[model samples]
Target chain A: MTLFIQQLFDGLALGGVYCLAAIGLTLIFGVLRIPNLAHGTLYMLGAYVTYFFLVTVGVPYVAAIGLAAVVLAVIGVLLERIVFHPLRNAPHTHHMIAAVGAMFFFQAVAQAIWGADFRRMESPISGSVTILGAQISWQRIVIVVTAVIVLGLLTWFIKRSIHGQTIEAIEQDRTGSSLVGISPSRVSMLTFGLAAALATVAAGLVAPINLLAPTMGDALSLKVFAIIILGGLGSLPGAIVGGFTLALAEVMTSTYVSAAAGEGIAFVVIVLVLAIRPTGLFARAVQR
Target chain B: MLTVRGLSAGYDAVDVLHAVDITARAGELTVVLGANGSGKTTMFRTISGIVRPSAGSIDFDGRQLPDLSADSIVKAGLAHCPEGRHLFAKMPVEKNLMLGGYVRRRNRGRVRELLEHVYELFPILHDKRHQPAGTLSGGQQQMAAIGRSLMSDPSLLILDEPSMGLAPLVTAQVLDAVAQINRDGIGVLLAEQNAQTALRIGHHGFVLAEGRVVLSGTASELLDHPDVREAYLGV
Candidate 1:
């Protein structure tokens, strides 16, 4: 029972992390309709930014996270301006090629700047507390709490704010959005920057536990893609539900079976579930 | 308030609009009548700056419009209510209407006034304000679409095929709303396939065929013309 409770916390914390990271990708996909392969790189960049701020600049963890988010947002704006803007009208194939190229470019740049090292950052709050015979880390709890708050705020923003309303409107009908005076280009720029900033905040929270490496984002992005697909592409609630579901499934596979099974099980479940419910778990139904 | 002189534009190599010339004056409802594929929509697109003119010019209130972006042209007091009644189907009727006021986002007071104005224009929309746009009837959806365009408080509105797919009665209600909007002092450049009804409400009309203006005359002249009667009105 204790082992089960411990693993549940672990799964929940991991799910929270996944939810944060997957949201950036999902929002970019949902609003912009771009398969943002570079999201993974932004995640890696965010982790690195956090590392640089925490270790090199020697700021407090909270301040470091804040600084890293801002830096990543600026980087995101630059990324949109320099790369995505020019290729905005390219064919889908070109978009795919460009994103793959961007991933490698960021990886190479990181390698040159930081070197090929698998580095780890120490959590500000360490050690574990026992409750109901299960040991839980303070950091993990923070992850879960922060995820809920962030997602809740995001939901609120989209529901109540004018800018979020514009995004929602555009997602519904692009031509209609234009008539309402919403500039798709400007919205895209802001969304990319915001998604990048969100990625950095998620990275800042999770990097201490997962550690950091240039190659980290590749597998993480694949996992997030599975999450987005499982949740229903472009659906916010779907992403959250999918993230938790994927994390629990992986954690259960690791606990009951083998670690190897955990890694490959997401793909297996995706293939099976997608085969049955083609449009995803929460696909937007066509209205009359 | 709007002028197009020898405007030629198209998608890539194929020209969809050929040297189109038209003018829409303030306080008048100008109708551009055409069958499907007659470049009426392409003309609207050019006027709203969705597409650039390959030749000639689009002047709105003495400012060049062709080179400006769609949003800029919208900011310059032109609004387009596109065909097919493209409402945000899943969103509330009020949100769909509020999104129309996106350009004037900074002005909450004006937006509130506009909201009240639109609600008054289409009282049904206010009654169904909280419902998702998809749940509205065909007539109500058309009213919401028109109400949305009015939220921007545009000087000249380019309405594209406002009567598409609606029943004759619903079309009449929608056209009546357009005339009411014009009476409120906005210039209306309406495109329609329903020639007789459109001419009845319009001050003047232009006919487009195969991307060229085939006929141009006052409302009564267009209704009485032999070619327009044979080709469009079926009289």
Candidate 2:
């Protein structure tokens, strides 16, 4: 029973990373109305930016996360202004192509700057604490707790903040939103920038727990995409539910079934869910 | 006040409005009457800057309007209540009304006052304020859309087909709100296919057909015109 409890906690913490990453990817997907194949590249960039700060500038770990978020947001805004904005009206395929090009461009830049080799950064969080009979790292606990706080803040913003409400309004009816005096282009820029910055927060929390490389995004983006699709595309709470569901499936499969089956669980579940409920688990007629 | 002369606009290679000349003065209601597929909507869209004019000019409040974006036009005190009651379906009614006052976020007290004003204008909206906009009845939704447009405190409010898809009783209630809004000193440019009801409350009216204004006159003159009576009034 204690072992099961430990595994469940581990899965929940891991789910926090998935939830943040899915929100980042899906926010851009929802507002900018772009598939944004380059999202994972932004995620990888976040980890590297923090690495740069830690190794070169030597800021404290928490400060590195802040700097990375700001830097990534700038990069995202520049990318949208220079590349995405021009193609916005051309065709949907054109935007998709630009995103692919962006992915390769960012990936090449990362490889040139940081090299193709994988590197590890030691977690400043030291030691572990026991819950029930199992032990968990402080870093893991901090990642989950901080993610909850960030998610709470985001929920409040979308529900209460004027800017966030404006964004939600634009997402629902672009023409009406503009008719009422909100610039769609401005909202687009801000959404993409914030979404990219959010990718950094996910990376800052989770990248240290795993191996990092330029190719790392290629693998992880697929999983995060699955997480969003599972939760129902463009639904914020859906992302939350989908993240934990995917993580729990993986953890449970690994514990009771097999490790190989654990890795493959997300795909299997996605196929199953899509076959039965095409819109997804949480996607209804109206999604907030 | 708003003026359009020699205006032309449309989707690429398919012009929906042509050389349309119209003017709307302050504190008066100008109704543009047209049947379905007529260019009334395209005309409104072009004037609001949703569709860029291919030629000629639109003057609003002493400035050329073709170059301004829709949001910029709204900020310049022209609010468009688009067709289809396009409220954010998932958002609360109060939020929808608040979003109507979005451009005035810097003036919180004024926004609150605008909210109260809209509630007074449509009390049902205040009662359903916390409900999602999509769930409202057709007439209620129309009221919300008009109330939303008023939230921005626009000097000119452009309402496109507030009568669409509503029962006759509901249509009267919604148009009553429009008449009241006009009486409150805002310039109202209304596009409607219901000539009888629209002309009855309008100070002036224009008839549009196949992308051009076919006729224009004072409301009583339009009501008396044989052509308008034959084509639109179904009298």
Error of 1 at A47 (Å): 0.8
Weakest 10 consecutive residues, lDDT, candidate 1 chain A?
A: A279-288
> A187-267 in candidate 1: lDDT tens per residue?
777788888988888889999898789988888899889998898888888889999999999998999999999999889
TM-score of each candidate? 0.97, 0.97
**Candidate 1: residue pairs that collide:** none
Q: How much is the lDDT of residue B109 in candidate 1? A: 97
Instruction: Report chain A TM-scores, every model.
Output: 0.96, 0.96
Alpha-carbon deviation at B52 in model 1, angstroms: 2.1
User: Least lDDT summed over 10 consecutive residues: which range in candidate 2 chain B?
Assistant: B66-75
Number of the top candidate by DockQ? 2
DockQ metric for all predictions: 0.82, 0.84
* Alpha-carbon deviation at B72 in model 2, angstroms: 0.3
What's the CA error at residue A50 for candidate 1, in Å? 0.6
